[model samples]
Target: MAALACSPADLLPLLGGNATSAAAEYICGRFDAVSSKFVDTGYAVDNTYLLFSTYLVFSMQIGFAMLCAGSVRAKNTMNIMLTNVLDAATGSFFYYLFGFALAFGTPSNGFIGQHFFGLSKFPSQSFDYGFFLFQWAFAIAAAGITSGSIAERTQFGAYLIYSSFLTGLVYPIASHWFWSADGWASPARADNLLFGSGVIDFAGSGVVHMVGGIAGLWGALIEGPRIGRFDHSGKPVTLRGHSATLVVLGTFLLWFGWYGFNPGSFLNILKAYGVSGSYYGQWSAIGRTAVTTTLAGSTAALTTLFGKRVLVGHWNVTDVCNGLLGGFAAITAGCAVVDPWAAILCGFVAAWVLIGFNKLAEKLKYDDPLEAAQLHGGCGAWGLLFTGLFAKQAYVNEVYPGVENRPYGLFMGGGGGLLAAQVVQILVVAAWTSVTMGTLFFILHKMKLLRISHEEEVAGMDLTSHGGLAYEFEAEEKKEISF
Candidate 1:
């Protein structure tokens, strides 16, 4: 395809000593006449931004892979890494084939999307395509969380079945409830508003993170504990990760990726605050979101350090990594809605949320290898309620045009309406996720395909499942055979 070209006359300079004053006036007059008629249209810039952010978010799979790999015994490293890799490989196709349609299909029924399969219904514009690709990345990330929690024990084949169900069916419906334009939870709709206008989950703390968390919860329960995870008395045994360095490194990658996950949720910076091409408004929101995201993570990491020290007399690096993730998950729902101080407060509480939930899950005998339920689920729910408690009305109005009826925070004098909606939002999503994932895992369990044999688990999944070792170099040298 050839690029569009302007006429030589259009290129004629209007400001020069050599040019006549009349010519300059004519050029100026022509530009003014056409400028308003053909508005900037900003499609290329906006779509490109979406593509870039989506690409960045896609990198989070690496973060998840490394974090899970390092958190597990060295024997499961290859298995864990392969699962993360397969998430993107398989999840992309699954979401592309059916998930996108189920999530954002037009003529929505306010429950599930009723349309979408072929391109016959979807627009072929840059924005449409960009939105699909961007959300595809997010959908995969949400599914990836489950892989980590179920690592080391579950059969590789069973993981695939659950993955397909989640990315194709479970995740999309959960996302549609809060993100799709026609969803009952959508603020744009008036009559179905959960509280003031609707439920508010700006960047999917409840949608993405909590969905994963709930699935992780059911997965842990159904799969049961790994070998040696509990004693004869049912006391929990500490099975530490193999590499703190990799865990910390993975944490850094996730933190970096969140710059996209949070700010990029706005979709279009040129038009987010209303009146297309309001650059200042978009830029302001982006900057504020970044500051809040950073503060939340930083404050939570610091808080976790101190809290862990007090709890165990030693600062646990894995806890620190979880703290970082919990903070990121906690602030995601409100990054664009709340002030920096609120983000700090949200993160400060998020660290303890992770700590508290981690202990509680252990106490309750939930064998979550990666603590996904506590970090993603608990902190994600916290993110939504934090927004309802701290988001300002003025910012809400700016973000949502004609937001007179929309909800805002409690401390900002907006009452407890939004907070109530947030509580319901998390509960409803949590229930939905539990039922669906529980059924999926239960079916797999009944079929005798959920986990590997006890012998295989004792021998390590890497050897039995993949037919190889993740740490071949670490193997002891073979002794000479006797005659």
Candidate 2:
């Protein structure tokens, strides 16, 4: 047993003492007296931000499942849901195995990732594994976006192959160039030269959404329209989704989740480690991003409702959902930079653009079941341009201190430099994604494995591909009749 004599007055001086304080411990003790300080060392689980991001991204998967299942014929609902499930499960496995390495590798060069596999050579302390898991959710979302566009027609095996390639290679490579530290689109890199801002994709407009849209386009082009989708004279036919209720529900989920998606991309709201702990470095930027994203989504939904009324003379729930998504997609590139008002304006414009592209794809005979091209590609391009037009000097300085901030846009009283950069980024993404995804589709087509037989298409994917039906009720009803 050890005893020490220290009064409350004695401890107070020790805590914040002046040099003149000479209070002696005049205690004759049998045991040694020692003072020790304790540090609360902890490995913080930053799951608040990661969980939000994952939840948003995972919700996108659910939305995708519902959207895909709704768009397909009722008989193929189970098959479509299965496809969405496989996309997350299998795609997540691949992303963890190899795709993450490619997308977020330690930079040997500023081009694509040179690392070969998952977590290769990365020190455990350098990265939180949860970060990788969150990114995996994004990879899964990208792969699933195309599932609806080619629903009920694509072969199951072929779909798997495409999903694997999209998650493991295509999306990873694009994300690396944009989101990774050594990427060409890295904001720190002055060598890009084409843009003063270095292809500012705050979230993943060009990376995730555009990549998914391009892949969907290739798949649709290779597979052709669904059977009975066109007459002998090539007149178009509109095939309705299985359930509008499911579609609306999915849209609401996605809308709620976007609050997490754009803001959580900050990774750390409390302390983001990029450039000397600037005010706009993490928390502030993310706060603004949340505001912008919310504003844009709301404006887009309203604009879509109004646009459909004016154009089609009826209120279409599907278009409204698409409008909201399109606005979200458009703002994704610069969600952290643009003001909330700018975001609302950008979203309002994006609704019209998305609707235009939807109609345009139809005129071109492109059978896109989900309008991914409009929601991602057309509106994503708008996001990039909006950054040029709406990015403020104060926000830029706070976000990236010591970096040369450019003032452009019609409102900011600057010239066309920023706009030029936006155009360049858009064109580069379009060209690269189109060429690569198109080639992959061409290879699949040459193998004659892209689409199932015409008879199988009519039977629906649930039976032809998966050998199952969504509604066992109908089957049971027939059995009762026979009995």
Candidate 3:
């Protein structure tokens, strides 16, 4: 909340010498009351905006469920959908219990947060319940991304264990490293900025997307690709999804949710850019952020449409959708600081980044059913680099204030300090996620709890573990009476 610009004492000069002391006191009391009301109104409006954004971000989970359901074979649709549901349900429990604390607990060191465990001393001056809800939505999204990479073949128990750990510990720690004011890499840090600029991950391309993607990369690598993803002769075989309709629908839903994911990161829409009465402010910046996000996603979709048409000889909606998401992931880091034109470039390159990663995955026989690692991980890294290269100095100052002559994008004539900080963010996120999620995946694999038996893989986990196939047309047909 903003402080009152004037106090009754500051206004005392306006009173004439003839005014009585009691009359002056009465006027000051009224002024104080009005000032208190203004503060209350600000909190009310900001909280409403935050809660609405939280709902939009939470809706992305439904989109994830639909996308995961369509990407996998029909035999495992139920199993994948169930995991998506649990990603939200189970994620909520753990994230609420401690994830919020670990990510945003203030008065702590640069590494990990140590206070607010179980939301102790709730709703302090710095944060409120709505803020906690908003962060919780982001924490679960990281878990949702990893579920896509290890879909179909991963065991149910393993999913439970990894999802809990990722949401509760792994993902929160990454967020703390970049988003928290006390974070080591946060641009909002008051002192000792990384490389004298700190990371400018405005909306968490590295903190969320890269963390999720790297974790998925390790899981898929450890699981050794889904059975029969490669033929006996080692040629890559295409395992097409069961439905393009769900994929398209899910993509659109996610696109809708991203408006909240990016713009809502501002957390306050009523803030002014300069004076209190000025037309330009955080709201205008929020609109600009939305524009950048849209441009990046749109450009990536078109690029993928043309690029894939040339390579695959036909239009692929699923590929285009993935490309669109890749663009969004890439733009997330610099959405507030880069121009719309720069966002187009970010998206244009992100499409190729994803396509290139997919080709490499095939060459290495790495199988991700939804291309989660490529679209999120590969493009997410590109987004951080994009910020380092293109972030505008004026916009950077406006978004991250309290720093004088701060470093901006290297390409924008601000020097290489910001770029170096971004590079550090990418390395630290990759290394940390690999150490934690990678080790957990490897341990799960050694215990035979990561993948199902060969027979179950062939039959699909939906029937063996989930009790039935997602679609039961044949079973329904058998129930018909003979004439």
lDDT of 3 by residue, 307-384 (tens): 999999999999999999999999999999999999999999999999999999999999999999998999999999
TM-scores for every predicted model: 0.90, 0.86, 0.97
Q: Return whichever of 2 and 3 wins on lDDT.
A: 3
Whole-model Cα lDDT per candidate?
Answer: 0.84, 0.76, 0.92
Could you arrange the candidates by lDDT from highest to lowest?
3, 1, 2
User: Per-residue lDDT for 1-483 in model 2, tens only?
Assistant: 123345544554555554232333332121123311111111233456677677777887788887777767887898789888999888977887779888776754777776647676654544667678788888888888778777878878877888888888888888877677777766655565345655667778877788788788888988888887777777788888878888888888877777777888877655544675465446667778888998898899999999899988999888888899999999988787777889989999999889888788877787877888768878888888887788776665555445564544646654566667777778877887788778888888889878888898888878876768887888899999999
Give the candidate number with the greatest lDDT: 3
Better of 1 and 3 by TM-score: 3
TM-score of model 2 relative to the true fold? 0.86
Which whole-number lDDT from 0 to 100 does residue 169 have in model 2?
A: 83
Worst 10 residues of 2 by lDDT: 34-43
Q: Report RMSD (Å) for each prediction in the order shown.
A: 4.9, 6.2, 1.6
